[model samples]
Target: MNTCFSSYRSLFPVLGDYVHLASCSQGAIAQPISKAIEEYHASLLSVGTNWEESILKVEATRKKFAEFINAEPDEIAIVASASDAISAVATTLSYHHTKNRISLTDLEFPTAGHIWFAQKHHGADVSFIRSQNGMLPLEQYEKEVTECTLLTFISHVSYHNGFTQNLKKISNIVHHKGSLLFVDAYQSSGQVPIDVREMNIDMLCTGTRKYMLGIPGVAFLYIKKELAEQLQPRHTGWFGQEDKAKFDIYNSIYAYGAKRFETGTPCFISIYAAYEALKLLLNVGVEHIHSYLQDLGKFTREFGIANGLKVATPTASSMYSGMTPFFIDEASKVEKKLKEKRILVSSRKDVIRIAPHFYNTKEELEYAINELVQLVK
Candidate 1:
């Protein structure tokens, strides 16, 4: 056991009974989450409406998440979901005028692309770059991005196959073309390290549910400082106003920074759970987690290759994350087979996806691989 991550194992007692390799679909719930939920319920039962404590914890979690991504606290906004977060950012932009094209990839999760695609009614020209073999080549972005391109939207890590893209290169191209870059890090945050400043990301959205070790109904959005301070979102409420407590009907002064992007009251329980998850995941640190997953990816990739399994993820070892989707006939049935053996994974289309977190042990991976070797063909 890695002493650095051994502390996490005790928190996640559920892993002892099952070989859980589906962290991408939903992360494992542990002691911290249970305790956080218990505390949330206790507070509701006692005070019922005292939101000051919960609000403070949300702010603290924002700072911690900012630290994880090397971003400023004010740049982060707590959102209801990734779809809402990206949509809020979308509402702030001008799509009717010059540079009306929105460039995105087919590899992105539906949540990320749906928001942009819906903009077609508003005269936003959306172009989707298709992937040839479960991975979008960087050149695809070059082909998609043009002078008329207003923004380049892509996933930091693909959900289906766990292919991590080169953000710096994409960001550079987007900037050189005088366009903005938005990254959906739903499959990357906590499992990978990111520096928004270094990567030149204009905006980024991710939820605490997937890979962040929390439940649904809560997410965070990082809008670059300038955009957060300047651009005004079309959809917002009192929570986004400069003086939310004042209750002034006439005045509509949006708050500066990411706070302005917020709409209404947040899910307090979800916020509490997300805060706790960030604390636990940050303990292992993203750099260490990322490095550990890379090694595990190498192991899984080799195991998959040796077993005559078809790979849907990146062939290059360095680009792999915790997720390794093997192409299997009747993947849903194959997943059922693994489930019969007390292993947990996910199936998308014909691909069986396995995502192991830092808490997962090598023996568990080997055991899962052994079972898969028989079931894959």
Candidate 2:
């Protein structure tokens, strides 16, 4: 156990009550997040109009997120949800009638899948490369990617199986075929160390509600600086305009970079909450957090296997994130028993998912394992 991680558990206030091994779905809110939101709301109530101040705050938040993900501030766009962000990026791609094939993985979230599917109605071909035993096969993707392929959309981590895709390798393949790579990073953003520049991800979308430890209805998209200028906005709003403050003018051009994707007035409260959440994550450091999560994941997997429970996630610790999926014979019964015992865990079909954050303690992990062992027996 590292000394850095030993002190990491002291930061979160929520560890006192429940074990909270579900940060993959929704992270535990830190005290700083609560304070930040309250202060922002108080400002709104006291000062009636502070658009300039609000913009500054929002830009600061974007810069923090960009720095965390190794991207430029100009490349980041604050949106409502991962779906909204992905939709904006997907619609912006240059899709012609002839070269209209959009490649996607079968394991993609519904939001990303639907965006590409809608293109089929517009005479574009949508192709899905199936995952081999919960892993995206590079060979399958290579076979489907053609000169006609306009975009290849994939999830950085599969939501159900917790299998991580090598984005850098995949992006190279897509770029070589002259196609854009759009990544749904909802599962991997905060939990894993990501660098957009190194990965060569053309576009990426992630929500703040989950591992980001924020309120819902706030998300962001990252578009490569070079590619941002090439795509056209499909659903443009006043905020997307170059002169967003010019209300008197009916006509205005969309701004450059990822801001061109902003559809309308954003949820200010949600953004404020997201800002606080991101700040906490930044302070803790993503690399350190990822290393801690890997330990938790390894513990959960090894414990499950030792106790005769089925391990569903990848066995390789390096490839795994905080998310640990396992199963007992009667998953529903086990879930109910665990919940009744105040041992929180979620079930997806037959697999029980356990995702612990940096704040969670080894005691909590042991308690969860004990409860699971009792239920299995």
Candidate 3:
């Protein structure tokens, strides 16, 4: 157990009940989130449907999210979900002529890939790059992304197999070919540090759920300042108006920057919880969290493999994110066995994915790994 996160464990009541290693599927709720929801209900009762705080929460959460990613508040837009964020960006692209091609990998979560794939309806020549051993090689991206490519979508980390990619390397390739890079950080954001400027990313989106330590119904889309000014998404709604608070019912002019991507009303309750969770995460420091996860994940993969469980995460320990997928033949059986022991973990197809958060203990993971070995035997 890392003594560093031990003190903060009490903040997550989920820790009290189960050995939570399912954060990759759905993060265990923290104590602050429950308190935030109670406050939301109280405020709703007191204010009687007034939405001033709701509006403020949407913006404040966006700023906090931007701070976590090292982006400007103006560059971030609060979205309803990851799918909504990707679709908004997809709708903005002009899929007209030879430059209408979009490239994505087979490993990307469907939310990130499907929207662009559907762009075929709008005349986008979508290209799918194959992955080798659950990871995409930089050479494959360079080959498919050409001068005619309008955008290339890549996942910061694979949700299924826990394979992490080098966005900086991929970004340089896409840019050299005169195309923009859009990243789906849903699996990477809070678990790892993201600096859009450092990665030279054109746009990106991630939800509050999963590694972010928040519930569903809220997400963020980050657009580079220059791209936000030039792009206009067909997915715009009344909230995207130039002066939204002015309540101009007849106006069509969109707001400047990433706000132009925002649609209708937001789910403020979830945003409030997300903000508190991010505040705690920032205080803990993403780099420190990444380091800790690396240590734990390495131990998990090494021990699990040595004991005859096939591990599917990246070979490089740094490439291993918080999650490690143990590719067991009887993954479903193993998952059921773990739950019966009051140790919670998840399985995706034949893969039993183990994710340990900052609040989790080394003993919990060791127990889970040993249980998995015995189940397989």
Candidate 4:
């Protein structure tokens, strides 16, 4: 654990003044990200433009992303946002044009829910497996995934309650009924270690802004190699073509692999930043990061309950995660007070969320909790 801390700590520049506990919303900007962007800008200004160098840098970025997620480099495609990634994959699924139903959890993010909902206009049936108090029941999901279900879309981690769903179990259940599992991994990707091959995820999409520690405009999508050929690109541009730079007017064949998802001009700046951010996380090691996060979550949960604050996340270490949601009578007031104390936390509905990353120390958690105890009192 000490070794993990030492390695992980090196990736983040110390923000000594503030105790940042909002990694679920947005991660802190790493120094490497800033330096990478500066170097990229300088490259743009140098010489009579080096197209090959630019493409190689972008490819290297994709390789870094692939390594981070344990995916093939060719299976990754850079996109504008999580929504774009979802829409690209969701719209391409041939089931969207059919009358087959789509299953999703009630606690899904708006982007995941809306993308599936939009397909209803085209004659698809979308059903949300009702979650009990934002907690998804495995049996309920099993019951809802029927023969008519063409796709099952779910958030790997609930943004509101911080519940991490069992994707492997859910995928198996869905696949048995001839349905594909499309996961919105935005909340869980960077903080958690995800292996798509091990989980049998047909399609997964996530943005870099949150735990990924990148700028907001960058995201990526992973399509299982087998499913890539089945998806008919609904939104395609020159970038998706067999030869992106080719000016041929007649031939129109989409590129193989995930590159087919990208539509037009890429957000090069965000991509560059995201690449560096992913590289930093990869160096830190995902398993180490996850263990550190689990410890942080445990510490936060214990401290919150020891005080007067009501703990909203599961008390068990196995069930809970880095995101811990707590509650106080006056959530708004508590949030304001914490902000004044240079402690950051987000309020969702009646619950106050304190999500910290690997870099955050136990001492910081104690400080935040102490402040919360005072606010609640």
Candidate 5:
């Protein structure tokens, strides 16, 4: 066990009760996050919904998430979910004759494809790059993404098989063709170290419900300042305006930078929880979390393979995210059985996802795997 990382497990009381390895679906709630929720409730009862304090928390959380991704606070928009963020960006695109193409792949989490495809009515020509043999090659992007390609959607890590992508390499390919890149980092944000500037990302979105250790209502969207300034989102509201307080019915003036993408009042309670949750990640450091997960992911793959289980995650450790899935018969049923045994996991289609965090111990993983082997056999 990595004592330095595993010691933080004490902060999550659920870990002491259950072998919680479902960070890919919903992270185990930490004590600080619980306390933060309590504080929100208490404030609601006392102050009776203070907008001033809520707005402060919203900005604070936004700033923390920006720091997490090495982006400016002005570049980050605190939206409802990754879906909402992606949709807001989608509406801003022109999709005219010149740059009418939108490139995507099969690995995206349905949300990207659904949102982008809907733009077909607006003169958008959407195309998909095939992920040959469960891997998305850079050459595929080079071949499919032409000068007419307006935007290319890339999942930082595949939710199905934990196949991580090289953002820097992909970004280079997208830029060479004069197109924009939008990354869905929901699977990789907290567990993987991401520097948007270093990777030359044009836009990105991630939700807090999974590895971010926060709740479902809040998500962060990062758009480069230069790009954000040019976009005018039609799917916007009062909050997206320069002055959320001023009720100007005649004007549609958007807020400066990424804030322009925000719509209506955000979920303040989730903002409170997200603020504390990001603090925990920043305190521990994402680079260290990535390093620890690398070894843990390797263990999970090897152990599953050794136990006669078909590990479906990517072979290389570097490509592994926080989750390691296995191709099992009746995966959803197996997930229920694991739950009956006080072991939690996630199931999607034919695979059972084993998602761990920095606090998960080696013994816990071994025990879970051992129990999983018994159930499947």
Candidate 6:
């Protein structure tokens, strides 16, 4: 057991008996997250409302998340979901003229396609770089992302097969063609280390439900400071104004930085949960979490292959995230059987996804894999 992470396992009581390998779909709940929820409920029950304190919590969470990604606090925006973050940036883009192409790939979660494809109504030209055998080729970006491409949206890690992209290389490709890079880090954040400045990401969005160890209803967005100042989001609301407390509706001046992307009041309870979760992740350190998860990922793939399961995740360690998915018929059925045995996993299509976090032990993974193999056979 890694002594550094082993101590943290006590914080997540679920690990005592159950084997949770579903960090791709949802992270196992921790005690801190539970306490955060209780604190929110207590405030509400006692004071009737906790708007002022909750807002401060939101700012703290925003700053923590910014630190998590090595971005400026001003560059971060607190939104309801990754979809909402994409919408704010997507809607503000000018898709009428020469630079109207939105480049994406097949590996993206459906939400990425749904959001960008919807931009066609605004005269946006959306092109897709099809994945070859569950992996996208770097040359595909060179071919598809042309000079006219405005933004090339990519998921840092694929939700289907755990295929992770090379952000720095792709950023170079997109920037060489004078196109902006928009990364959806929902599947990568908390499990992988991301530095917006080092990666040269024009925009990025990630939610805390998965590897961040928090509930849904809150997400963070990072936009380059210069890029954020260039345009105003069409999806702005009262909270997005320069002075949300001013209540001056006549002249609408958007808030400076990525805060302009925010809409109405945030999900306060979820924000409270996110604050503690972010603090926990930061304290543990993303670099350490990534290294531990990679070792687990390798263990999963090797064990599955040796057991005759057709693993769908990339064989290369660098090209994959924490998720190790193996092809199986009736995957959802197998997932249920595993759940009945107190081993939790997630299934998408014909593959059962086994994603582990830093808190997971190799023995737990072996047990989950052995059980899954038997169920599939």
List clash counts for every candidate, in order: 0, 0, 0, 0, 0, 0
**TM-score against native, each model:** 0.95, 0.93, 0.96, 0.93, 0.98, 0.98
Q: How many angstroms is residue 207 displaced in model 2 relative to the true structure, after the best TM-score fit?
A: 0.7
Off by over 4 Å in 1: 1-4
Full-model lDDT for every candidate: 0.85, 0.81, 0.86, 0.81, 0.91, 0.91
Residue 157 in candidate 6 has what lDDT?
94
The residue ranges of model 6 lying beyond 4 angstroms of the native Cα positions read 1-3
The local distance difference test score of model 2 is 0.81
lDDT agreement of model 4 with the native: 0.81
Cα error of candidate 6 at position 203, Å: 0.3
Predicted candidate 2 versus true structure: per-residue lDDT over 43-104, tens digit per residue: 87899766776777788888988998999988988898888887786666666876788989
lDDT of 6 by residue, 1-377 (tens): 56468888989999988999999999998999999999999999999989889989988988999899999999999999999999889899998689999999998989999999999999899999888878888989989899999999999999999999999999999999999999999999999999999999999999999999999999998999899988889998998888989888789998899889999999999999999999999999999999888888989999989998999975644597888999999999889999999999999998999999989999899999999888877
Scored by Cα lDDT, where does model 5 land?
A: 0.91
Model 3 lDDT, residue 365, Cα: 83
Tell me the tens digit of each residue's lDDT in model 4 across 166-218: 88999889999888898889989889899998998988999998888888878
Model 4 residue 5 CA deviation in Å: 1.9
What global local distance difference test value does model 1 have? 0.85
Model 3 lDDT vs. the true structure?
Answer: 0.86
Query: Which structure among the candidates has the greatest lDDT?
Result: 6
Model 2, TM vs. native: 0.93
Error of 1 at 358 (Å): 0.5
Worst 10 residues of 2 by lDDT: 1-10
